[model samples]
Target: MSLVEINFDGIVGPSHNYAGLSLGNIASASHKGDTSYPRAAALQGVAKMRGNLARLGVQGFLLPLPRPNHALAEALAYDGTEDRALRAAPWSASSMWTANAATVSPAPDTRDGKCHLTPANLVTMLHRAQEWPDTKRMLEVAFGNGDHFAVHDIAPVTFGDEGAANHMRFCEGHGTAGVEVFVFGRPGGKFPARQHEQSFRLIARRHGLDPARCVFIEQNPAAIEAGAFHNDVVSVANERVLFTHAEAFADQQGAYDAIRAAFPALEVVEVPSDAVSLEEAIRTYLFNAQLLTLPDGSMALIVPEECRESAAVWKYCEAMMASNGPIREVIPVDVRQSMANGGGPACLRLRVVCDPATVDPRFLLDEAKADLLDQVISEHWPEQIDPADLWSEALTTQVVAARTALLAALAITELD
Candidate 1:
């Protein structure tokens, strides 16, 4: 099998709205109560995947998990009596940020030589707590070929696990064994530490990873307090390179030393805090960019437009490109809608290294599939979703119909 990395991005959902659900997510909190454009959000996401398909030649997408989750609403017994946040929880489009969907250990890193994925039992907040079962079901369908893939139930709820947003892997190439870093946080603060240390330990064991190759590190407490909710918000790793802000970890040198001990060929592309402060990185999502190994053996950083708009961030990127470093290209894409919802390019995807043929083709994106997505989203997705509109039965029906239409178009009967 020709093993390669496939980024399974989430197609933004029809119920995309700004309910300001995620705590410690500065963007989400700041945009709460603002009207959101669902059609535009989803289209922007598709456009991103299209760019990925062109660059990598193979792009897969995870469909929006069934939303306006009536089961959750019924379980909460939400009869218009609870707080607005509770009422809006059932309709949140947060699932479109697929980084939190699961944590994956590619075939190269696992003992069984079969790629393993664990759906995150996102028990952090009420809005996201109800997502795992549906997320797991969707994953099972996407990676159902038993011979090459294994999707396991999350090992468990108590210790919070926010999935790939907090995890990074390093290796010489995508097809080789790598060091997996599970970044967890120290609790007791204004904002809750989402990825508990215990949770990642559970995930590491669940994936049957070699303990020697797994490095458990602590995210900088200051970064978390500064609204750097996940490690990806402060750092990102791709193949042999680790691109990071200076203050991304509690013990920056220690983190580097640990990684080097396991993989000696590690390349560090450190962005100085003098050029861009921690506050600037978090605000612009400078580190949340996707560091990809392009098809021709060059590396590119897929950053949000906000990075270009910022003088400091852009200057740093320009210097990095001119320095003859591993990162050869700096490409900026417009994911403004997702960025406003506390997700940049990285948050919209879950990366898996595997043979594309082993995946259910319905999850992969081709030109015709792109066109179909544009049409379905344009026709069935709501043009604008006001915070108050989430309560409308008409909007609920539209959201359900839009997802069903997408499932039908893809011939994904399991999700339907």
Candidate 2:
């Protein structure tokens, strides 16, 4: 199997806004009711995709979900007199964080000799819970090759499953067999723990993954209380490298021991709490970065521009890189719009390990496709979206049309 890791980034939707619908996300809450720049956000996302394509040699993208999704609004009785949070739920662009799109077990680890995916039943928040149906629809079309891929329906919503954000894979290489880690959180925390243990167990069974090869680890309650809403917020893994915060797991050493036992070659690069507190880590999203293996075989940490600005985070990054660690380079990109809305480089992408040829041509992104995205997003996406604009009929029409234009451009009407 000629497999490689392809990052499918979500195109920042025209209805992108700072609704602060997520309770555990500090950035989203802090920037609530702020003005959002949809055109700039989408353009920034495209630029990031272009950069990754240049480094990784291949890239893919996921289309934005239909926004101002009045289905939920109508079901909830949207009568203009509803609360602002409830009103913004329909227009929330949280779907741009593709890390929460699904949990995937690549072919190398599955019994069927085919990659498997289960869309997340994100039942934790009303805004996010509505994503699975649309997300599953897109996944079906993108990875429709039955011979290479098996995309399964989401597990029951009774147990919250926030998808790949809380999951990590360990392997010698993208094409090799490896251990999969499912990070579940305990209750009685300051915020609701979205990833349930049962949810991932069901996903593993559905994907036909060996029970012994899958490690169910507990996310640090301290980290979650300190605003690390998802595991990606405090840790990220790429192949054999697990770049994480010292307090990322409930039993940090035990968590390491478990994974290292499963895949002994695990190279862990842990950032201590003294070097950078969990609060600083969450605030700067230092761990919520794309830890990518470049074409040269060296690894790079694609972080947000905010990491560069933070004195503590930048200093730690410089020292770590200077130490000649597994993460050879630290690259920063401008994704401040997404950062404010509570996602970063890793959050914007879904990492699928497979041969690019098996994927639908429409979903694959190339230089020309990147150019098209730049043009369409720049031309059709809204320049500004205020909280009040979510209620505006004209803005809804514009948001809907902008996505339609992009779908038409990509010739991907399956999503529309």
Tens digits of per-residue lDDT, candidate 1, 91-114, equal 988889889999999998988889
Off by over 4 Å in 2: none
TM-scores, all models, native as reference: 0.99, 0.99
Q: Give the clash count for each candidate.
A: 0, 0
124, model 2: CA deviation in Å? 0.4
Once fitted onto the true fold, the runs of candidate 1 whose alpha carbons sit more than 4 angstroms away are none
Per-residue lDDT over 1-416 for candidate 2, one digit per residue giving the tens place of the 0 to 100 score: 58999999999999999888889899999999999999999999999999999998899999899988889889889899759767988887888999999999999999998999999989999999988899999999999999999988989878999999999999989999989999999878889998999999999889999988999999999998888989999999999999999999999999999998898999999999899999999999999999998888999999999999999999999999899789879999999999998999999999999999999989988999999999998889999998878878899889989999999999997778
Superposition TM-score, candidate 1 onto the true structure: 0.99
TM-score, candidate number 2: 0.99
Kindly report the root-mean-square deviation of model 2 from the true structure over all alpha carbons.
Answer: 0.8
In model 1, which range of ten residues has the least summed lDDT? 78-87
